[model samples]
Target chain A: MSQGSTRKTLASIAHGRSGDKGNHANVAILGYSQDAFDWLIGFLSKEKVEDYFKPLGVTQVERYLAPNVRGLNFVLKDVLAGGSSASLRSDSQGKTLAAALLLMPLPPDCPARLFFKG
Target chain B: MDKVRIGNACGFWGDDPQAPAHLATGGNLDFLTLEYLAELTMSILAHQKAKNPQAGYAGDFITVLQSLILSLKAQPRLKMVTNAGGMNPLACAKKAKEVLDQAGIVRRIGYLTGDDLLDRLPDFIRQGIALENLDDGRPLEPFLSRVVSANAYLGSEGIVQLLEQGAEIVITGRVADACLTVGPAAWHFQTPLEDWNTLAGFSVAGHLIECGAQVTGGNFTRWQEVPRYESVGYPIAEISSDGSFLLTKPQGTGGLVNFETVAEQLLYEVGDPSAYLTPDVSADFTSVEIQDIGSDRVQVGKAKGRPKPPLLKVSLAYRDGFMASGTLVAGGGKAREKAECCGQIIREKLRQANALPQEFLVEILGAGDSLPGIYQRNDPPEAVLRLAARDPSKGIIERFTREFAPLVTSGPQGITGYTSGRPQVREVFRYWPTTIPRDLVPFQLGFL
Candidate 1:
């Protein structure tokens, strides 16, 4: 915790979308601004995302940098059971995976908070 | 530079049926594309075909084309392309031709076939072609008897061929969804079939608007920015000869076309951004530049392309097992606890009956357990407890469906919401994605 700093959820700084590829699901988190994108590049690592979605029994989490869209895409493997057809989960395609990731708490001193107002 | 504007109104079979007429009449376009088939849609159509010989295609296209007859007549130059032919292109084309004839419009209806591989599976096997799964390298032998539908994704060459041969309306089966756009763009610009860069650019544009409203702010994350949902206009790609294009919706129509909306769609259902593989060309989406040129208009250009893959991807669906799910509402006090308790009761009863399924899941909808541990929160006033299971045996799935009703009277005090009766057991159509050498499957084109 830093002096005069506040903590917030990742949703405050970024928005995302997710879809399925067979049993795997890919979630793309796009930062609201260039500063937020830079901040996300440092804070949102693959291990952190994997840990966040650990309850989903993700086999592997691979992250790809998309500076073009100012986004980071995380491909969570074996997370959708058997995906669209065979998966029994209500969120079979992992449509809400991005919304779940957005719930991750941001650090107290995260600089991206400047874009948002309380 | 001369440009051809192509608008896609229907993304899939069940998409807004009125959109094709809306886009055709509104956007002064050169071509209109309607994509219908998804991965599992073919299997469904296969089942339909098995019941009736001439009933394997997307029937929605005929209804939509009938509505678009006046619009098509109004814009004489407006051509249309679609893959509404799921397992049967000839039947789809025949129905479409009847619609045009009834409307007193004389237009050539061209169709492309040979993508359906169900009949040719044994031939491929005899030729030493192993139709192994792309995800897991298991050969498609053990599940051969259970296989329903198999179709190879064809490319834009046949589409372009049809367009060049003066086919005003092109209907196809199992062609790459993007090829619906690529075919028209390539034919319009007279681009060589091997011009990977141009072909890739068209492919990217096709991919962007193929889902209709997706590129036009349908599922946008910043949904507030999109105005007028009552009639969100479909997407239009105003493409030029050099492979650059501007994406926009119809004038005065609701929905927005911006960098964010376009970018979001670019990532939709795509695995690797750098290399988006297709039958026509390998598109390098990483190099693609999206610029918001104006309100409801975004310019997308500079998408690099590589040589097309030697293999064509095939979508194979088989009867894996049976699945059934039922949901009940749990409320009053600790709703989460009650929901879990109800789930347990169902599982226990199923176990006692010796009807344990291969896969089972219990989801507490409103309790933040939809993604399980990701959204942990305290119990709310009410929550939906959904119980789902899958098994190789239909008897087990049918047994699982019957367990939900008993929870209302016997299990938790809060359990109620079972008005829909027992959930019906559905046959699980498992998907198998694989690739085959391009030369193996032949492409056929015809007119109706």
Candidate 2:
């Protein structure tokens, strides 16, 4: 549908638990260590959170910014568990998903702290 | 004879993807060249060797080869030459063949190597050849133990040899960029190796196409006026057997080709322009000609040459240990003042921890040191503070990282930009370049 809906869908797929209400599963809270939070959300920020997750089926990712602490909530669609089945990950020439990812500039500014507490 | 038209697609591994296809079809070219090696890239590849022995060399070349495979198959007359082989041409060739085999193309591919000097360093040093730094002129002894890789920039002759050997595709490692285009022209024209003028002209042609679309319009200062930027075109070198060539690009592709575009590409790799030295000859880039051929086409040719300098250039990468940088901003009218105070505070904290390097640097961007005389502002409201240092000593850099947060409260203008904790130390790989006689170094060519 819209960009927002896609992000929410992708987030669900990445951290969702089994047996969700619909195709969108619950976004799992993958632990909340300050270090882990900083790294995960910080990686998102460093890599341009919205752009990075957009292709991964994360259409609408709501990120809450704070001083040294923040959180990003997204809706993920059918963007996980397929591995070799992702279209955005590979564009027809066997170039790895990592290679495609490298071409996109990381957000010029990285989050100072963990944007995601959970 | 028909003019030898050589077009280029990707300048380096990270270069734009659509370049080769656009230039090949657009320029109506006979040959295509892709140049993809820089001094810094060589160092990065050397660093990769520490983890994976076969990891050195740019793999993007293979990707580009794959991208153009279908196009080449459709156009049998289109021969491609590239130095994407990096430090390992034979290995690169085999990988390329793997891709070709998948495409059902059983063409004879030629690979040229011998650019690296891994086995001959000790002998060269023993022969009294002090491979001094071209920039600082320091002898390369201190870095002997940490030296990881060393390669000389070969010229067009080696590539010419491969082309003459009936190679449908020629791959090389660390050859001068200009040599990529020059070699094919020299081979096709059968230009005598000693014909300095023609060689220099071909050298100029090579230099023009060396950066791919840079000569066409990518990154040109006049980029604003370039048409259709969504699909920017790459450069094409139309060469004649007599040493004259034109610099241009595909029709209808985004990017401009003019004297200014050619001039900017010429400005790259600064040396005395009158005597831009290479292994084959010292080129006189000053005598070159650039004329607009048509829409998206510029004719460039008529260059001069001199004898090659006696010493060959070498690139050496050694383990210089690790480094890391952390930054914070202190705002307000006292921005400059606050930045200074932060530096002092970091020094104090690191010193008390007994973790300061023997030599370290603390810089204040927007401060006089960062811009030096570039920006003339009347006491800017904010300043970006930076600190850098290195040491042969252990834990010094990590110790320096721990000192930043204290400055958040201690510094004059408070703090900003520090979201993550103190930074980590990263090992630094340094570069060294030296020269040796062409006769001294030897190479072996075999399939992997």
Highest-lDDT candidate: 1
Error of 2 at B405 (Å): 6.8
- What stretches of model 2 exceed 4 Å from their correct place? A1-118, B135-138, B222-230, B326-342, B362-370, B377-386, B401-425
What is the per-residue lDDT of model 2 for residues A1-118, given as tens digits with 9 covering 90 to 100? 2123213222211121111111121122221234544554545442353455344443443333221111232333333311111111111112122212222332324333422222
User: How well does candidate 2 match the true structure in TM-score terms?
Assistant: 0.71
Return the top candidate by DockQ: 1
For residue A14, give model 1's deviation from the true position in Å: 2.6
- Candidate 1 has an lDDT of 0.88
Candidate 1 — which residues are off by over 4 angstroms? Answer: A1-6, A113-118
Which tens-of-lDDT digit does each residue in B1-448 have in candidate 1? 6999999999988999999999988999999999998887899999999999999999999899888988887888889999998899999999898888889999999999989899889878878888999877999888888999999999999999998999999999999999999999999999998888888899999999998898888878778777998799999999988788999988989998887888888888777788889998998888898899888889989888999999999999999999988899998879999998988887888788888898999989998867777666557889999988999999999888878888789987888899998898988899998999999888999997
